[model samples]
Target: MNMSEWLVRTARRVPDAPALLSGENVAASYSEFAANAARIGGLLRTRHKVEPGDRVAIFMKNSTAYLELLYGVWFAGAVAVPINAKLHPREAAFIVEDSGSKVLFVSGAEELHSLLASTCTVHDIEAEPTFAAEGAAIAAPEPRAPDDLAWLFYTSGTTGKPKGVMLTNANLHAMTYAYFVDVDDVLAEDAAVYAAPLSHGAGLYNFMHVLRGSRHVVPLSGGFDAVELSALVPRLGNVTMFAAPTMISRWLTTARETGYSGEGLRTIVYGGGPMYQADIEAAVAHFGPRFVQIYGQGECPMTITSLSRSDIIDRAHPRWRERLASVGPAQSCVSVRVVDADGAEQPPSEIGEIVVSGAPVMKGYWNNPDATAQSIKDGWLWTGDIGTLDEDGYLTLRDRSKDVIISGGTNIYPREVEEALLMHPAVSEVSVIGRPNAQWGEEVVAVIVASTDRPPNPEELDAHCRSLIAGFKRPRAYFFETALPKNNYGKVLKTELRKNVSGL
Candidate 1:
């Protein structure tokens, strides 16, 4: 099935139902949104000469127009390349050039104007989305094979240069299925807010909600703000939004201060980064049963293990805390495994790289055969995440494959130590990294952001770790910083952190 068909089919079913919103106001109905998409698609085909399989990029922030452009691109039988609005022009230009996109839909971002003059044609989104009614009318969404490219997701380039991950129509179909089966029981009345970047996981979920004829809401702030989100809870009832773990933590703090119980929130599907056990438990205590945790990568999008709300509140089980600490069992469609260096499966309680094989997996990296070969082998995506699966099939992630610390022949996962440090009352956010040491080979180091007015000193933090984790895993040195460097996705940049402590 063509992904764009979801919008067209649902519009036919519920023509007058609200389909898109900007803040508290209704932006478009199902019928109107479909008509606009058809008009834009018609323009792309007849006027712009966009052919099937061509890449059409959208370089705009989260708004009503962005969503329409995404659907219109697919409707026109072209692949959508959604660029991060936060990226520099040079970075965005690289993706436009690499994808060979002939046209770009952009807002009035001064940085992106240079790219319009260089490689691709540009369309300003601030103007009314009106197209001449003259093209061969689009009767229906153009047909394409299941494996044809639907989205070209460029990684955040934390480890290296960003590579375009080719997500297909079939991959998105599997993702939508996993959403209904494992994520939540979404309803037609449920609404999804786009506070997170639409270019990333937040935008990918547009189809899943659109499939149910739910509302796609873009916050008025055009970005995430805890204060604004709390106000919108009751205004937009039964709301669900995908967020990073850091955003969840910040929102919880704001909720407490404002006495907002998240009265209308249905679920907050958090995944982009690790949600520390201490932080999650606190969030659940405050927000009630409204959290679902997922673990996925760019290669697979958001179809991975999921920890449901029932599992979060299920305290009667003997291993409830352990299960809560895990990213949960694999989803219905994907097969997950933990394998050693030679692709051999690891036994329970042993750490190995997490690999996935399923329909949701991407085709390959675009125009990069070497990266494609390294990431996908035998139809399995090597996720570069180190984790273990328990007897109950629960998956516990230790750290990224590149983030492990080897100290005196004993390997230590940073997440283990970071979790311990987070238990401290004074610690707000913490990132653990390994620094080269001649004596122990690589020493564990903790870089912290203090939560309390009176920050805990190194001596106090050292004793705190000794009481919780193994002494060898305790930080050899502690550095107090106002904040840790992070990417747009809220993951702590351990690579930059490592560079900061390189001379140590």
Candidate 2:
């Protein structure tokens, strides 16, 4: 069945139930949402001439209208391409052009409309009329095939230009099923608060509220605001939410200052980057055992590995606690393996690149056969992330293959070095990158953010690293900065770091 049918089913089953609530405004119920989606779908078809499989870009912040547009595009038998609102016009236009989106939706942002108007048809979402009067005129399209493209997500291209990953209706349905299996306890009564950008996979997957007929709440300002989140916990009682590691760090600080207990919160799913054990422990303590750790990518839509509440609760044993550091066991629908460069599977405890085979994996990169060929081989999506699987079947992510630092033929994972630096009392955040060296080929370099009023010297930090990790893995150079640059999802932009420190 087509994934868009979920909205129709939910609307028919629970027409009066709350479908979407954006801040103080409520979209009423599933029937209302479906009607609005149909109306918008009709408008796109009749006025905008949105054809089947045509790419319609949503370049707006998180809102009730954004969700409507997503379903509307799919209902109209077109593909929805949600671009990052934080991206500059040039970057947004690149995505629009790359996806070949014929029409773009813009809400509350005039600059974005101005940017896309030059390349494609631009529509202001606020100006659109409600479906209440357009019922008789609006016509629903024919059923969509499971293999029809539902969405196009752009991944950060190692080369200069980003590539769009084409996800089919079947891919999304598979992802929703796998996600529900991983977190079966989340039900219709639960509400999910979206703290991440709606453009990213984490945000889009988390917003799959149709499966369980749950309520979706987007922040008022359409950005992560700690103060607003603290208030939202009480307003939307017993809600589940997801955030990036950096957002969690900020929330931890805010929760401490405001004495926010997150008492009504059922689950706090975190992914996009590795959260430090200390941070996870702190979050678990404050929010109870509802901290679920998920590890996946845009290609997979977040169903690879999951660490549930039980895993975090069983942290008494040092070994068990160490398992919390892992990304956890593979989910129900996915088959994960660690393979060498030659695509040979590695034995237990041996580090190699992590590869996954699953229904949720994207069909391929849109219009890029070379990249599609490089990523998907023999039906397995090569993640490019290096990891190891224990005899117990738990998978531990070591580092990304490109991020690995090879110094004098010894492979050094930056996560190991960064973890040691995080243990330092003076260190608040840290990132490790490899630098070119004349003798060792590539030398390790550590960049750190010291605690307020406590600056750490390079020799002292280097000594700490040496004490914790092997000498060869220790960073030879150290740079102290007030803050480290990170992407929208809280992942440290290592590419930016490499460019910044290439001279060093």
Candidate 3:
């Protein structure tokens, strides 16, 4: 089924229901949203000559217009390539050129014209006469096979240059279904805030909310600002949003200081990075049981293992702490396994590479057959993350295989040490890596961002680690920095850190 059909079906059921919001103002009702999308789709076909399977890119910040163009691309049976608005001009152009997007829908980011110069035709979505032109009635929803491409998601490119992940209509449908059963329960009155980058997970979640005929709200700030989010949440009742862990930490600190109780927040689905156990525990204490964590990659747009809201608040359970540390069990509609080097499944509690096979898995890396082959073997996508599945089926992520620290032939997962250090009051953000050592092959090095202006003593940090984890796992050395280098999505750029260490 064409994924756009969800909007059509929901509009027919609740024509007058609110569908889009700008802060508290109603941007469009379900019927109006559908009509706008159809009109935009008509413009894409008649004006831009966009055909089935053609690629159309949108390089704009979070706004109602961005969402309209996205659904319109899908409605027109073309693939939507939503580039991160914060990406370097060169980086953004790479995605546009790589995806072969014929027309780029831009919204006043004058930077984009110079960025995508001579690459693709740029259409100012706001100024497009066809976008505002009326009398373009709702046309028949384009027919697309389940396997046809729906979205071309570009990876954040920490490891190398970005690769386009080809998410199919079937993959998105599965994600929408998973959100309902495994993520959260959404009602027609429930609204979702697009506080994170709409180009990434936050935008992908539009499917889940729209499928339920819920409202899609873009904050006045256009992006996340804890103060703005704090004020907006209470005004928009029963609101849910997808945020990165860093964004949540900021909200937690802001709430505590300003005494903002986060009223009317239904759920915050956090992913993109590990939410330290200490951080999540504090969040639960302040927010009161309203966070869901999902662990997935670009290859699988956000349907892998999910740590539900129930798992966050059930602290009285004997295994609650252990479960909280885990990313949770395999989400509904996917088969997760921990496989050894030879592609054999590992026994319970044995750490191995996590692999997933499901409908939500991508078709392949766009135009990169070698990468596609390396990632997907048979039907499973070999996620580079190493993890273990307990007897009860909970998966505890050890670390990304590339980030493992090997000291004296012993493998030490960086997450283990990072979590231990995060427990220290002085430590705020830490990234543990292996530095080259002649004798041990690699020595554990902890790069930290202290909570205060005064850097925490290295000995004190090491002493704290000794109390929480094994002695061998303690950092042999520590480096203090004002902040850790991170990508636009807030994931630490460990590759850049490695380069810094190499120079040292």
Clashing pairs in 3: none
For candidate 3, lDDT tens digit of each residue in 1-504? Answer: 777899999999999999898988998999988888888788778867889999999888899888878888888899999987765455677788889998898777676577665557788866763553553644867999999999999873334366899999999999989998999988888899999888989999998788889999999889888898888889888999998776787788889999987698999998876667988898989888899999988798788999989988887889999999999999998999999998999999998999999989999999989989989999999998899999888999887765766554344668767877988988899998888764345678889999988888988887887765557778888998898999999999998888888546
- List, residue by residue over 1-504, the lDDT tens digit for candidate 1: 678899999999999999889998998999988887887888889888999899999888899888888888888889999987766565677788888887788887666677544557778766534542444557799998999999998763334255899999999999988998999977899999999889988998888889899999999999798999999878889999998777887888889999998788998998876677888898889998899998887799788799988998899999999999999999999999999989999999899999999999999999989888988999889998999999988999987765656554333668778887999999999998898764345789999999977889899999998766557778989888998999999988888999999796
- Each candidate structure's TM-score, on Cα atoms with residue i matched to residue i, is 0.81, 0.79, 0.80
Q: Native-vs-model 3 lDDT? A: 0.84
lDDT of 2 at 390: 90
**Worst lDDT window (10 residues) for model 1?**
128-137
Off by over 4 Å in 1: 116-118, 127-137, 156-159, 403-504
- Candidate with top lDDT is 1
The CA lDDT of each predicted structure is 0.85, 0.77, 0.84
Please give the distance, in angstroms, between residue 280's alpha carbon in candidate 2 and its true position after superposition.
0.3
lDDT of 2 by residue, 242-342 (tens): 77766777787888999997866888777776566777888778767877888888788777888777887785766886688888899888899999999
Native-vs-model 2 lDDT?
Answer: 0.77
lDDT of 1 at 250: 81
